[model samples]
Target: MDTSTGPDTVIVGAGVAGLTAAWNLHKAGQAVTVVDPEPGMGASRAAAGMIAAVSEVMYQHTTMRTLMTTSAAMYPPLVAELTDLLGHDVGFRDTPTLDISAHPGDRDYFSALAEVQRAAGMTVERITTRQARSLEPALSPTISGAFLVSGDHQINPRRLVPSLIEALETSAAAGGPPFILLRRRAVEVLRAGEDATGAVTGVRLDDGTVITAGTTLLCPGVSLATVGGLPEADCVKLRPVHGDILRARLRPGRPPLLERTVRGMVDGRPVYLVPRTDGEIVIGATEREDSFDGVVLEGAYQLLRDAQVLVPGAADLELTEILARARPGTPDDLPYIGRLDGVDGLVISTGYSRHGILLAPLGGHLAAGLVLGTAPTEQDAGILAATDPRRTADPAVVDSASRDPSNGHRTPRERTAP
Candidate 1:
């Protein structure tokens, strides 16, 4: 844990967010250290990597959709940058997404939503089910309506993770080093001062070694709560929402199983199927709230049953792999990012629900810009303002009261545990 070169910034978790932040920090001439228990096996690996903003829009809110659309647009440039940095193609593909409906009610709802999105200046085109099937022969004839969103696309999240890792490794390989990828667990944040209210100095490892830094970035997916600095209520409130998906190996003579990211409402539930250039058909996602472990459940099996109604041939295909991973979801289905007040130098960028992969570039850029002294651009500023940790701060606590609860409040530490 003792190194001659002290890190300017310490980033926790090697998921997309952490890696992206490390990349930005390194580019900005800041000495960064990225610490994570696992490299490529976090939530980023479990993501389908569908960058569908319009197709995946919420029924009520457009804020997330707006952020997603902007992030989706930024992916091409980001992917190009990563590809150039990594010296390899990371499977950044520009493929439109289709949101189709099997039932009349779902089709009607989609038709209305399409109009709403179009009126809002989004590029959405309505197509008949037959026309949808014409674009991709695997689509079920039972599909009543579909909307083609031209701005949406997909990338290989699995490939992106390793590619970023390689880029980091390459930068390390060269003598010009900024961050060291410490493949170890971060047990807790070390707080300085009498009230334990000063800036986060570093993290303690399970092996009893301490690595200190000026700034600590917590990008650990579901494990963000395990860090000791955060309030027990805030920490314990963060739970995992498990999603199970199936990757089908393609056979010869079968033209792609899915042309683009095909999302549909089957039995009043949402299902998305993404096709990769390597002839892999990815059919996803059963969102179950109660599951903590990453074991595939019966609900995931039922997902396939529902998906086959949209694409009947899916059942006939060989199941390459069944992926079950837990997504870090906040109660309100939004991400928690930005600097916390109590802990001076600790920043969190977790609880990204399901759009973590699609939103990585912008999220990383904003988080990195914040950690460094560099002023964020107007775009980054807007996003950072929305996700600022101060938003989660208790408004009742004023000035010095907000800095540290342990000294201000006489409540025993035992009463604070959830």
Candidate 2:
């Protein structure tokens, strides 16, 4: 590792949230050094990449709804800026999303969910199955209900991560404060005073290299508690909520199966199909808080079986990949994205869970603003408060459960819309 020591900020993870924050800081003329063993190979790579603010709303997550919608609105400008800088598309698609239900029970569930979405000021319109089929001819005719959410969109996280890396590298090459990506695991965060009053000086890598900076941002995802030298790390309460996702490509000469993203409720379980321009469709995901780190047979079978029910053409597609990754889940299902208490120059920006891709821009902006000493607007201030890392709560009260001793994994947790 280079012994240089003037990076304004040091980021510990290079996932979407970390990379996005690095890009924002770099664009603002701040030198950034990102430390990660493998950048973008974590949960960000496995995400289905749906910008589903409108379709992902739940019954009681009002704070999450506000964060999602706000971040959804920020995507266009961020994409445009990234495209202008890179001189190419980063795989952001403004296509609408269709919410459909297969069974009568599923229809009833969505009908109630629509009320919650509407109450949060989201645009959702009920459409007949005929109308849905008219828009997407390949949809199964047996679908009992449909709703059009034109506000929801999709992006390719695979592309977004590379673009951010390229932008950061380009900036570094342009002769300013250097942007460094240290290919090493951060072992500890170096602090300058007592545990209760210390300020973050930099991070100590696994090999004992210290990269000093003015501020240190922790985005280590599920490994937050394992990072040494942070006294309050365990208090953040992060758990691994694993999910299995799949990718399939349309066979040659086959027309596109879906024009946009299609999310559905099949037998009361949520599943989604997101289409890309290059004849690929992403199907996902089965959420479980299990200890199994690899793709499960039952989870993969369920995704494939349920996807075909919504779009029967899914059965004909060629299965290309199957992956399993754990999202960093919080007790309340909201991310921790603010300054750490009693630690100066240290920002905590992990625990995004399933919404990491959807909330990247907002998380990046807030994290960078915190480093730059920029005051958030009134609207953003409320979101910052809701996501404050120091907020006190009992982690055991949530819907998640401990790992089962009989089985290798825990019980299936409640599923949320993708």
Candidate 3:
């Protein structure tokens, strides 16, 4: 909260989104500071860290595919840089992803998804159940269909997060950007201008401390979407899409269950298995929109059942961790990642849905560009339009007015929230 050591930018969340932005800005010679109640402990901590730009095409939108592809492509350089900075590997694996389905409905759905991916310029090849099992002998004998995608990869956030933190802290300690993390919640965004919404002056912490910055990037993930007093808090509607994930360790002497990331759909639900190098595997993610409390029960059971149905060896592994966290989901399935309508010096970079892990690097880069007043390239402009925070604020096709605090800017609506 001290202005003497004030940062040029104050990032509200220290998750992957915020961290990457801070790192990029610091590298660009900008003094940055990130604040969070609990850093590295958000949905990023619970994520499976899949960078499947092509294989996990959930929608048939060009913008989504473009963003995913660009984001996934930034990982190699990003990982290498982070590894060197922290003197440790960030756990990046350039493994192929196997898509399989045992049921008729799932097979049909995967087939349709492949078509969409192909239309989006993804290289996909259809394979028989025999070939699928040949790649991974552990695959269930009942698989009816499969697709092999070559462009997808994975990372371990468990390793990436710490490396990122240490790098930033080390830079700050050596008199770089003075980048620091405030272990406090951001209660509100301080505003200035005759209308009191012209420029964001700083952030008021929950502990009654005011940390002023030239600009503020709000990346507080999904859990803080409903928090009051922040600009556009209401405009960016977020639903906590809770995911129940299971981490298991194979007993000693057992070979790897699967070589690559295996995604499957049983019935109408989707599931995936991500293998790690330490003889551990991550089986995820049962999606539920009903509750934020991560109680392990039906969803966890279903993930295990479905994963076992895909890979029989899943049943024999020792379950290590059952993680349940809600992803900040937008109604339109796109993130809010640009400046506010009338609120200068404030940017929104949350609502990533399930692609937070993959999009972190790009999100941070774009956000820093916005703060530095750099002109976005032709492609970046389109992405900004798709994720504009003002889209859901007012129904008018054009911005008739600046984002006024009096008009409940604190409660901007998600495009379509029930």
Best by TM-score: 2
- Provide the global lDDT of candidate 2 against the true structure: 0.86
Best by lDDT: 2
Scored against the true structure, residue 365 in model 3 reaches a CA lDDT of 86
Would you list the clashing residue pairs of candidate 3? 234-410, 234-411, 234-412, 235-411, 235-412
Evaluated at residue 229, the lDDT of candidate 2 is 86
Clashing pairs in 1: none
State candidate 2's TM-score: 0.93
lDDT per model, in order?
0.74, 0.86, 0.80
Sort the predicted structures by TM-score, highest score first. 2, 3, 1
**lDDT of prediction 3:** 0.80
Put down candidate 1 lDDT per residue, 123-230, tens digits, no spaces.
Answer: 898877778889988988878888888788888888988888777777767754566888888888878888766778888876666878888888988887677755
Clashing pairs in 2: none
Candidates ranked by lDDT: 2, 3, 1
- Report the error of model 1 at residue 174, Å: 3.6
Writing each residue's lDDT as its tens digit, candidate 2 over 61-144 gives 667778888998899999998898889999999989999999998898888888978887778999999999999999999999
Candidate 3 lDDT, 255-309, residue by residue in tens: 7788899988777667889998888899888767786666569988888888988
